[model samples]
Target: MTNVSQLARPHLRSLLMHVPDGILDAPTSVGTAVVATIGVGLALRGARRELDDRTAPLAGLVALFVFASQMLKFPVAAGTSGHLLGGALAAVLIGPWTATLALAVVLLVQSLAFADGGVTALGTNVTLLGIVGVWVGWLVFVGVRALLPKRPASVVPAAAAGALVSVPAAALVFTALFAIGGQVPVPLDRLAAAMVGVHTLIGVGEAVITALAVSSIVAVRPDLVHGARRTLAQRPLTIREKVPA
Candidate 1:
């Protein structure tokens, strides 16, 4: 005979700390959805080009891994928890285009099936976590990799840096959305400070997890790791050069 709201109180409190339903105006939600749809459509086309026989199965496995990782949340601050966004991890394991599709699938499933994220806010979630997260992480990874030596060992640090930066970037995106159509009346500066601050700490955890995962894959199957593939390819060339005429 317990009250339903009382029963759901704990869950609701935890849920609200992350993006939830009824927080943004209808116009904002719809606009985010339109943009997300276009991004996903483009990602789908791009993913088709990226996924070969070798990468297609790997892409599916990365999606499954990211989905599972996201479920394991850790406390970041008072009454707030954070989990792996997994965009950087996915992009490092597969390619950025496929990573976007994989992350979008994970977000869609989480929203529709588990009700982990808001159904109406699925577009926002996908846009922030899937599209922006993947691209930002991928770009950072590429930039960092370029600065580092062309070695398999370098991929881990680059992926970690990408993961570290992408979390705050996503938080900033949310802050921008709130400025547009947030249901709450909190001041923009205060909200941005809170969101970005918490996410920066969360990004530390993201960087560690991303680094560990990328390092493990590079150690075991460097050739299969999309981010390390270029470095791995150079080994054969080096061996060929060592063979004198």
Candidate 2:
């Protein structure tokens, strides 16, 4: 058997959201850029419907939180690490449309100011994280919430479940894209298995963070949680018949 220490290990890479330059071919890069642009455009239009004086500031705060949290990466596997995606958390706190915009802003800052993600691959990152992550998480959250009791507390678990799925969903998308136009030749099966496997573990952390954040907001002000709004609004009004007064 080959000694583990004797084997040459590749440099550790954080695979949660950041897609570096040159990993994808020109066609893949350009295609994703167009898709990301269109998605952001639609998000701009959709956000108007979701945002208001009350939720606008909250949106900013959610973006900031996601930006900060993503910087904290946890080890997932040998030569790989992951971080909080925050898509489900944002969607639950605000609305999905607004959450998409929030993620875009955070990604843009990370790409430009921090150089955390490549400029060439910014669109790919946005497509994977902003569009795929946000929508998948929001859709899952909605589905989960629908199945649970219509209450503010339900939003927490629903958000967590969504978060749990979103990370691996994004990873799978990346694997597909890599298979399509990966600069480096890698077997599809191995790539898919590795990406999905590591991300599934990352998803657990995502779930925990999302649940805590959602629960905190729900406990303090359930009305402020967009995902819980319907539950709160659905509370039956108590009507009492006045007897002999």
**What does each candidate score in C-alpha RMSD?**
5.0, 4.5
Task: Pull out the clashing pairs in model 2.
Answer: none
Tens-digit per-residue lDDT, 141-204, candidate 2: 9999999997789999999999999999988998888888887655667566667877898899
After the best TM-score superposition of candidate 2, give how far the Cα of residue 232 lies from its true spot, in angstroms.
Answer: 1.4
After superposition, the stretches of candidate 1 with alpha carbons farther than 4 Å from their true spots are: 1-18, 234-236, 240-245
What are the per-residue Cα lDDT tens digits for candidate 1 across 118-199? 8888888888888888889999999999999889999999999999999888888887987899876566776666677778
Model 2 segments more than 4 A misplaced: 1-16, 239-245
Each candidate structure's TM-score, on Cα atoms with residue i matched to residue i, is 0.89, 0.91
After best superposition, candidate 2 residue 115: deviation in angstroms? 0.9
Best by TM-score: 2
